[model samples]
Structures are given as structure tokens and as C-alpha cells.
Target: MKLSPYFHDLRSAYQAELDDLTQDSEGKDVLRKRLAEKRKEIAFLVQMMELAPEMVAVVFHQGFRFARPMALEQLLGRGVDDLPGWSSLSADGAVVLEPWAASLAKAVLAEPGGERFLAVAAGLEFMQAHSRLAPVASHAEAEEDDGDEDAPEHDDDYDALSADDAADPHNARSREEASDNWLSDVGFDRKD
Candidate 1:
């Protein structure tokens, strides 16, 4: 799955954003409630359509179902300025929305850069469904790294998807307990 640097970069951020919404402090599954809240804020979030599509795109998580894999893969190769308009993609019925996404899509369509952002949103979703969100250094980035040997090999993204595991109380509790024991060994009192 060849990804444009744009989609590649946003993939992790979008996943992380969803992961953030997936659980609360008590490790309860709060995704539905949080996503609903985000949907209501679509009007405000539209402002970030192009600048930070991943942040705004979360409102549409599970909202897109791409019918044409090739088209989406092609779309991922284009730079931001070169993206196809949403009208074309939707016209072909290549990007289908979940039944619940209609009004939110309409709200987004009314914005200036909304169409392009939708295509971006779809590409992000496509990458996500295919499990292509893992970090892969692009050709240019790899070359740039060779000159500076001190650069970090990876982005410090939280687990590519521990956010998914966070939904399980068992995983979250074990992790919490492990952290407490580690802290105790380090001479700090366990956090109650």
C-alpha cells in the first residue's frame, strides 16, 4: 500500500486520535459518546479540514467504506494540492458513508475545502482498514536520514494501536499494575 507522505503521516495521528477517544481514565469504553460529541462540533471542526484533517476526520471514523480500492490507493499518492474533489469520488459511489454519516457529511460539504478533505478522510480510512498505519519511512525521508545519523528511526507514537487494546480492562489493568510495581522499584511510592 503505497502511501503519500501526507496520508502516511496522518494515519498514525488519526489512529491515535481514535485511540484517545476509545477509553477514559477509568478505562471505560467511551468511543460512542465521544464520537457523538465530535459529530456535534463538525461546524467548528470544519475550519481544520485541510490543515489538520486527521483531527477533524475522527468524526467520520467508521463512517467511510471505500468501494474502489485502486482509486483510493491512487488518491493516496497525490499531494494535498493535487487531491481529487469529494464530488467526483462520491459521484462514482466509490466512497460510501455509513447511514449515520449523511448530515455530518453535508455539514462538511458546505465548507470551503470540504471536498478535498473528504477524499483525504477516505484515504486515511482505507489505510486504516488495511492495517497499513504502521510507520514506513518514505523514500525521501529515508534519504534525508542517511545524511544525519542522529535522527530517530521511529516516531514516538503510542503502540501503533495499543489504543485498541486499551478497550480491554484486563490489558489496561495489567499495564497499570506493571507501571505501579516499576515505580515502587524506582523508589517512588505507587500512585494509590
Candidate 2:
């Protein structure tokens, strides 16, 4: 559906916020805390949409995937009166989404302006469900390691450290990133 410039801008800001949260100095996903803060910030907007869907321009970023991209484009190109209802849209747009995201979408679509809410809630829920934390190798460390590739001597201590790093609790992908990657794998741009 065509959204107002305000809503479009809001969507862009929302995606940018998520992108910013995806990485830290440690290259860890710090999205959970940030997403909670964002949910609070937009709580009122979500409420407003629930009360008045027609008045709000709800936009979802990579919220749904179309089996036929051209069909979706054609639908968008037409007038609102010609547009299909939420059920048709949802059915047509539905694809294999991550479990958390699928649940969130189902919940949001059950409410007023659920279609619109899908855009906001699905993103936050996806992020909350998929973000990860891992020890990021620094550029200097990577360069040093690259230069040492010629050394045939293998350090058992280094191998042990690598094994330890794999088992480290902090070194893992967040649920949000996994969900985001799923969307990307399905042909939707994460930032979109």
C-alpha cells in the first residue's frame, strides 16, 4: 500500500535504528536493549494505529515476501480501491518466515490494523528474537594473522583458544541476526 511521506520516513528511520544497533565496537549485536527502548518510544504510535488504521500509513520493512514480486508491484501501482484486503494480501505475501516473526505477524494481524502493526511489531520482534553476540576479531589481528600464514608451525595453544572461543557463551549469533539473515536469504533486504 502507498504510505504517506511521514510513514515512509518513519520506516527508514526504523530500519536505520536497527542497522545501528546490529554492531558495536565489539561487533556484538546490542539490539535487545535498543529495541525495548524503541518499542516504548513507538507505543503511542502503535496504539494510534490500532485505533485508526485508515489514518495511519503503516509500512513494514521486509515484513512480507511475495511469491510473485511483479504481482505485488502491480498491486502497489493501482489505486487503493483496487487493492486487496488484508487476508488476500497476507496470504499472497506470506512466505517461510522465522518462527518468532511468524508468531508476531499472526498476533499483530489479529488486532486492529494488524496489517500495519505487522510492519512495526514484526521488525522489533524479529530483532529481539535473532540478535547475537560474538568476539569480533580486530583488523590488526586479522592482518597479523594473514601475514603469519607462511609459518608452518601450528600452535596447540592457539587451537585450544579457538575451541574455547567456540564454546564461549558470549560468542554467538543473536536470534535477531538469524531472523534478519532468514529474511535476506528469502530475497528481502534486511535494511528495507
Against the reference, the lDDT scores of all candidates come to 0.76, 0.42
Candidate 2 to truth, TM: 0.37
lDDT of 2 by residue, 60-91 (tens): 33344445534443443343234444555456
What TM-score, to 2 decimals, does candidate 1 have?
Answer: 0.69
**Tens digit of per-residue lDDT, candidate 1, span 78-170:** 778799998989899888988899899899989888888888888877776766344332444567778887877863321233456557888
**Top-TM-score structure, candidate number:** 1
Estimated TM-score for each candidate: 0.69, 0.37
